[model samples]
Target: MERVTGVGGVFFKSKEPAALAAWYRDHLGLELEPGSEAVSVFRWSEPGTTTWSAFPEDTQYLGRAESRAMFNYRVKNLDRMLAQLRADAVFVDDRVEISKFGRFGWAIDPEGNRFELWEPADGL
Candidate 1:
């Protein structure tokens, strides 16, 4: 039987969409142009890339204790990505770290929601 290959898009609610979209473009260099579609699709560089994750509602992963939301991005450079976000003045939470899995980073959206960024280890 045929199975799911990868994620098609990410849909999330935002309040200051214009600023948020611009932040994504300037900070992370994402392809989220202003006046574009609501859904954003990120293509994987390598094949057969799939991941599973879970978060809790209270003190789960991020600072949000009432709501839980997380997402991962396959980035080429973790340090560089973090640097970019920092340079853009994005609020990055660096309280979490791992040895073998990958680097974990986060930033709250304009609507006060938590989002995760993952830069997996080589050959992960």
Candidate 2:
């Protein structure tokens, strides 16, 4: 089984999400969409392209620690991939979540960076 197909998304934290997003838009020319709070969704030009976004500095979504960022890796089979990681003595998180979007899992790297694995929903 393929371990990681590609990058799904890149997430990081910011003290002022709105100001930071505006900076990206103005300086980087990212066409940001308006959403609740300071969230922005940058759709992929290709069907299965990747996503990139920045989170709030105080957000604990990455982990309970002060992780600067988290990378979401696209996986072929999330369950199987996680199983393989565990079999190889990797510290895979026990929590597996499924939603309309797709399945999600987490694993810690040797450096202790908490990263996410995503198996996208069909037709996504």
Candidate 3:
């Protein structure tokens, strides 16, 4: 019955990860979690936080003034939750996409920040 269960993924723009990964490794004491240099994955734990959403510099999907990250919340039912949000007068994106992974949608918070909503398919 929860609106959101957990985070789905965290993404960031990492061009030339072979060189950039070393910086995160050396400075932040982070190590490669699963992916290789071509694409690095950093798995850390935080309260109600998770995902892999990297936006371009010109983009403002996460928040205004470049907040540096975006979060994708895991919902039980995308259609219902979106309807709830709509009834509550929250701004929900009109488009929804479905894939083998899940059904996805977007919503803007009161703070004018954009975030993602995902209803994972069975066993996903």
Identify the leading candidate in terms of lDDT.
2
Model 3 per-residue lDDT tens digits across residues 9-101: 765544454566667668866555565552334344533324333345555555566555567888989999999999999999899989987
**Cα shift from native, residue 63, model 3 (Å):** 7.1
Write the residue-wise lDDT of candidate 1 on 5-77 in tens digits: 2332233334454556667667876664244633233435864244332222233554555554455555656
RMSD of each: 13.7, 1.9, 4.5
Those runs of model 2 whose alpha carbons end farther than 4 Å from true positions after fitting are: 34-46
Q: What is the C-alpha lDDT of each candidate?
A: 0.53, 0.82, 0.68
Which of candidates 1 and 2 reaches a greater lDDT? 2
* Top TM-score model: 2
Where model 3 places Cα greater than 4 Å from the true spot, the runs are 13-22, 25-50, 53-67
- List TM-score per model, in order: 0.53, 0.88, 0.66
Q: Between 1 and 2, whose TM-score is larger?
A: 2
Poorest lDDT segment (10 consecutive residues) of candidate 3? 46-55
lDDT value for candidate 3?
Answer: 0.68
Distance from true location, Cα of 101 in model 3, Å: 1.5
Cα distance off (Å), candidate 3, residue 23? 4.0
Better of 1 and 3 by lDDT: 3
Q: Residue 82 of candidate 1: its Cα lDDT? A: 69
Model 2, CA-based lDDT: 0.82
